[model samples]
Target: MMGEDADMRTMLAPPMSTPHDAGRRDLEQRYQRVCDLFPDQRVEIVNGRIVIREVPTLDHNRMIFRLLLQIMAFADQRGWTACNDIKLFLGTQVDRYRPDITVVPAEPRMWDAENVYADQTLLVVEVVSPSSRDDDNLLKPHSCSLAGVPLYLVIDPLEKTARLLSQPGRSGYVQQDAVMLGELLLLPDPWDLKLDTGKFLN
Candidate 1:
């Protein structure tokens, strides 16, 4: 749903705060206002404010596409569902995110809806872009962890590296194992697989 009316481009915004750090209902209302107005736009509540990022660069888009395909292959072998850029409810009224790649249950709970519930999510992957570097590296990991997502993967195409963050807690991930391009990217527990990151390097 690209290129909509000019009025729909206008965003509803509120003063920023950490999600769940302040008025919960107010945050939801603020986001809902945008949702009702710009239903077609890709919007998210980041740091308790509506964050709308521009379309990704070519490198960023290619990396995201490659990773999504790789993850889908991995999930296919294990009979799990892997998807691209799907909206996630995250079980909190304050924030919702559409991860670059999302791994969920075979039958996701919120699959029928436009956005799926965070409960169905087993892993959330974010491919860092120039614009989203900080959030992908910091805020998003914390957000995904707090949402009870067991795994959070950060892929940096510029650096040709990836970080697998697991052992989620309220604060953030407790364990982090990083791998560079040409190195074996290992996923833990449920899907013990070594992912190939060579394509991401280029």
Candidate 2:
């Protein structure tokens, strides 16, 4: 399915509740307060609660930087808009997340200081780590789908595979394509770009 179709499906889907709904408000308030004090930490809210990830390992950092550089290069060449590690607010119930990489069509609003919400994000990429596999593959994609983010990419270094998720239906990605090393995956428009799996694993 195309990105536009996935977006429409996401818009029509109903909301899903997280496990920690009871103290959600309190947790959100505390997280906000902490964020006010430290804007550089890049904290996120997941499953109706706050989650702070530690500094990644050297290998993790290397992979993230490689992906970022590639995306940035693509953006530069194609005149697209790509952001690295930007916080995205995905749900009405205070679920915020920071995708490792996000790609959006070039828009003036993206540069505006007042526009904090990016409802037009075309693609979101997450680099999986031992501590975040569940969240990356399940919770994060579910939330993104509900919020109408068109495409979700999960790069699993452990498995040395990339899962491309499209057709975001009521329960997250309705269509999943697993691309192993030596294969290439093509993204939908406005990207319409091809990614080599070997480059990702290395």
Candidate 3:
């Protein structure tokens, strides 16, 4: 069963108390300070909103580790690598995300020292947390699609399923496919890789 900590991790901060634009910079600065104070947590600006997240649970980290192991060799063969927690700029200054796993070139030409543009990513993945169901299934896919990320994967342990979104369009991904955790998920085109979801831990 889901726990209270999971719910707390997904809590969205209230809207900025000050006026828009006029206080955006200040708000960002304050959030930056919070990040500096708590180095272990993740603080993100999502479409100009501040979203703070606690460190991943042990189960969460294990899932990411398994994915990295499977993806590393394939990515290395093509001069690409898989990573996590790297800030990704989503076509705007105030919109950024740190996907659970990202497939990127070994030597990415970054947008900045601390960020990589979403367009530079070959794929992004997010493992669903209890309170993040909607954001993981919808908001992030839409944003990543608009930012031209080639593929987006959403793994929901609660549902024991994985959903892959691809064929990006102005609105969002043009195509989507889903399968149970025990099935193989085929990545189309350029990737041509199959993920053995049977190994994923729920």
Candidate 4:
């Protein structure tokens, strides 16, 4: 997606808001201050707290790379865009989240090199690490849904499972599919990319 196209679509998307909780606000402020100090660090505000996990394992990194390669190739063929480890600002309280993978349709804002917002994202993918499984599997999905991201993909190597979530409701996805190895998962709207679960496990 191009930057200009994304900007136009963002105008139609819901506006970002701050979390209602006081604790969330306090943590958001702290996170912003820290981000200012260390712009290289990947951080996020989850469950009203500022949490930072280490870079993923070698296997995890390989998996992400492979996924991105595949997704990017396919997206390019279809004139779409795929980004990896990009910070998505969902709201004031939830400023920066580094999803392992994100896909957006061709739009100018999507091409913007400066800022990457959640509203620009059509799909958010979380490849679970041992240290980040809980947050990725539960909290992040709910947060992305609340932000109105269309699709959420949870890839868990530990369990060798891939779950596709869509139809976002107030809390999270109203529809979800747990796809095991050898099964294909379908994404919702915008792109509706189909992913083979078996390829994700290795």
- Identify the candidate with maximal TM-score: 3
User: Residue 154 of candidate 2: its Cα lDDT?
Assistant: 91
lDDT of 2 at 144: 78
Question: Could you list the CA RMSD of all candidates, in the order they appear?
Answer: 12.3, 10.5, 13.8, 10.1
What's model 2's overall lDDT? 0.74
Cα lDDT of model 3 by residue, 89-195, tens digit: 78533566878888888777688887888888888999988867877887888888888888999988889898999998889999999999999999887789999
My TM-score estimates for the predictions, one after another, are 0.78, 0.77, 0.84, 0.77
In candidate 1, what are the lDDT values of residues 38-140, reduced to their tens digit?
Answer: 7666578887778776776788778877777667777887778777768877665536887888888787788346688765677888888777888889888
lDDT of 4 by residue, 1-202 (tens): 6999999998999777645666667776788787677676667667766777676778888888767765777678867677775677677656457787888767726323634666667788888888889999988888888877778888898888889888887867899999885688876566667777777666
Candidate 2 on 46-156: residue-level lDDT in tens?
Answer: 886677776777877777776666567767786766776666755446477878787766663342342225457777888889988999988988877777677899989
Runs of candidate 2 exceeding 4 Å displacement: 1-24, 36-38, 108-118
The TM-score of predicted model 4 comes to 0.77
In candidate 1 the C-alpha lDDT for residue 94 amounts to 38
lDDT of 1 at 72: 75
* lDDT against the true structure, each candidate: 0.78, 0.74, 0.81, 0.75
Candidate 4 lDDT at 100 equals: 78
Cand. 1 Cα-lDDT? 0.78
Per-candidate clash tally: 0, 0, 0, 16
